[model samples]
Target chain A: MGEPLLRVENVVKRFGGFQALGGVSLEVQPGERFGLIGPNGSGKTTLINCISGTLRNDEGRIFFRGQDITALPAHRRTWRGIARTFQIPRPFGTMTVLENLRVTLEYAARERARAGDPAVEAMEILAGVGLDPKAGAISGLLTQIEMRKLELARAMAAKPALLISDEAMAGLSSSEVDELLEILLRLNAAGTTVIMIEHIMRAVMRFSERIAVLDAGEKIAEGPPDKVVSDRAVERAYLGE
Target chain B: MQARWLLALAGVLIVGAFVVTRTVDNRYVYFAAYGILQYVLLATAWNILGGYTGYVNFGTGAFFALGAYTSVFLIQAVQAPLVVLIVAGGLVSGLLGFGIGYLTLRLRGVFFSIATLALAVVLETMMVNWEYVGGAKGISIIRPSAGPLFTNYVQLLFVVMAALAMGAVAVAWFIEHSRIGRGFATIRDNEEAAECMGVPTLRLKLLATTVSGCLMGIAGAPFPYYITFVEPVSAFNLSYAVNSLAMPMVGGTTSWVGPIIGAVLLGTLQQLATVTISSELNLLIVGVVLVAFVVLAPEGILGLLRRGTRRTRA
Candidate 1:
């Protein structure tokens, strides 16, 4: 295969004496749907945080599209087309929903040299996420599902090549989970690579082409979804057997 | 309104101040108007960082006093022109602001607030010990002779301040409508989210601090000339911090117009109160109005007006 879209090499993160991620490594291919799953406190979020530049790894080298980005700050990393959604929704509360997307389109995506009106572009992204009707509503007043949709739409506004959805379906109803899954699927079909960090087996299993399972700061299993799920170590990690 | 209209409004206001100076000879009018307009500048400056960027700076006195002292030093040493002093003062204070932001911006919320408050105290102590600027005893400055455009030095100073205040308002308005302003709003709302979304929160924050501090320093440049008594006590007065914050809080923190409204409304009231009641009641007026607004109109007058208009339209 061509160069991986994202290659993380032996990332280690520590919060004082507690090792949050101990030398975890992974690769995400271009336009591929990748899943990261683990039990709670299994370093899933920690690994992504290091990848996204939110938490700098104590020891690691991160390469994006062939350039070493380990020393780049979060905003620089974002400008390079890596975008992420928060586990909890974090909308710019004082702004309208459209304005939230405008922030990304104007800053993150501006590097792409898009030549159209940002407001129109923002509306298109909102429509894609099924949030166009609430464009003028204050984001702080959005319903939970709407807020989640806004989060995804805001991330998508960057026109990112690699999009990381971090627990985007947590606290969502089953139907809502399916709705978000459909959006992620649509995005992937349009040629955007996706890394979905999810606790919902049904959604991740259906969505991810391949899966990597992390447990206690280690990647215990990685392969096609069925093979990784059926692995004995993966079962032990989840079931505590 | 668009930026050009705001510029037009600012031009009209400066001309109006000039007309007021030309027609009315009451020195008291200039005095009262200068006090009000100074707050207009201070509140607007404070709102740039405290309101738009969501960073509270109790160090308003530090920046202001630093600007005043900058002028005081230049005046004693080289007798620089007022314009030069204003520029130098802005540069010095802006750099200090950028430094403080670099050091303390990583500490969010109340911790940041405390750092700024500590900054004011530390600077105040520095000024007190620096004997060249009269140390704790303060120094007095003799005003430059009036320029050809005005009758007395105070009148010219008043007009200069009026122009500066209007310039400050114009800059604030421009920032509010631009993309930079939107970046500021995101930083205000959520810094981490802003960074992840490519807002460059640190750079935008530094910009806010530099511009905010620069305007405040300009506001203080004319202060030593106006008061003619350059003392650490008065230059570093607690009123500078309180009024700057209170005016923005009472007017509204979201837009440029809020600080002007708050400064005008609260400032005029203080002038009237000092005459009718007592000078001691000046801070009390700010205290009462600030509490009332915090409880009844926390968004300030602009937010209240927006909500009212929206309700009527709906």
Candidate 2:
């Protein structure tokens, strides 16, 4: 692959004396379907948080699109076309789905006001996430799967070159997971890089072009899905052998 | 079509009041209307942050007091025009709002509210002890001469206050319909989601609080001249905070029309109570009305109207 879209170098995050992420490093290439998987408490979320500027890492450098973004604030990172969906779906409950997308579109337009293209762009995003018809419904009234779709719609509304899906398949049935996975695949096919962090092994294994296994805040395995899944350390980490 | 009818009816009522007050020469009615206008402005200003953004500021009285004192000092020191003083008051209060919001917007929920309350106490003490602007003794304002419209200064004050009231309403309408307004609603509903969706929550909130404070300050700036006195106690009156909080809550905290309805209804009732009943009982009546609405009509009059309309459609 050419230049990596995102690079995390030796990220170290501590909560007082506890090290949540101990010198973790990773890279996501442009238009790559990368899977970040680990057992619980292996710092998957912390790593993503540091990359997204939600948490400051004491020792790390994060480069996004060939620029240092480590010290940038969350909204600044968002404006630079880095978008993320939370593991727990967080739609603006008091507003309609259309209003939620509109706010995101307006924010992005304000940052990069290309003349006369925002509304059409927003509607296209809504259509891509399969939320166009439900746009007028109140977000609080959406079902669990619908809320997840809205979260994805919101992330896409910023027209990010890279999209981070943090456990978007959590709490969904098998068919629902397939539906969401299909959407992620379609987005990746359309030239948007995707980093999907999921605990659902089958889905991640099927979706990731390359898999990286993090165990106890360290990269224990990195390879094709089949090789990483069968690695002695990856198996031991999951089975706690 | 519906909105135009409402506007026409409002115009008719205002013109009717002007004609009747002119014929009867009732300075009292004009004074009452002026007070109602002030409350309308205050409630609308408070709603900008408290209602729209879900950030309840208990320190509105502090901003109001700051505006009153700023105007008093400027008027006494350099004899600025009333219009200039009003705008200056707003600018001063807005700056204070920006400073306070920068420090405290990180605080969530009731902590932010408590911090704002403490701000009022600190401001009141500072103004009470500072002797530059007459300190605890208070400042007296010499009313600016009216330019030949009416020898009766009260009528002129009423007109000015009415214009300001209209301006406040227009601002509330603009914000309610704008993109900033939708961003505020998102922040109110879920700040994390709002930020995730790329809304710059801090900047939008700061703008809301600053604009809210500026308008409150302008509303209070003219009060020193209207009452012809500026004392720390009255300028920092806890009643201002109470009315600012209660009017919006009692009117429906969700819409622009809520505060207007609350202010006019509650303000007229308070004026009538103060005139006929004991002045001390006026506050008692306010407290009673606030409690009644909080318990019985938590969504306020506007919510009631919305529900009534929906039922009719059904």
Q: How closely does chain A match the true chain A in each prediction, as TM-score? A: 0.99, 0.95
Query: CA lDDT of A167 in candidate 2?
Result: 96
Q: Write the per-residue lDDT of candidate 2 for residues A142-203, one digit (tens) a residue.
A: 99999999888888877678889999999899999999999999989989899999999999
The segments of candidate 1 whose C-alpha lies over 4 angstroms from its true place after superposition are none
Indicate the TM-score of model 2. 0.93
lDDT of 1 by residue, B1-314 (tens): 46677678778878887887789998988888899999999999999999998999988999999999999999999999999999998998999889877854478888888898898899889999999988999898999889788888888888888999898888888889899999999999998899899888888988999999998999888888999988888898889999999999999999998899999999999999998999989999999999999999999998899999999999
Residue B38, model 2: lDDT of 91
Please state the error at residue B126 of candidate 1 in Å.
1.4
C-alpha positional error of residue B216 in candidate 1 after TM-score superposition, expressed in Å: 0.7
Q: What lDDT does candidate 2 reach at residue B232?
A: 92
**Interface RMSD of every candidate?**
0.6, 1.4
lDDT (CA) per prediction: 0.92, 0.85
- For all candidates in order, state the fraction of native interface contacts they contain: 0.80, 0.61
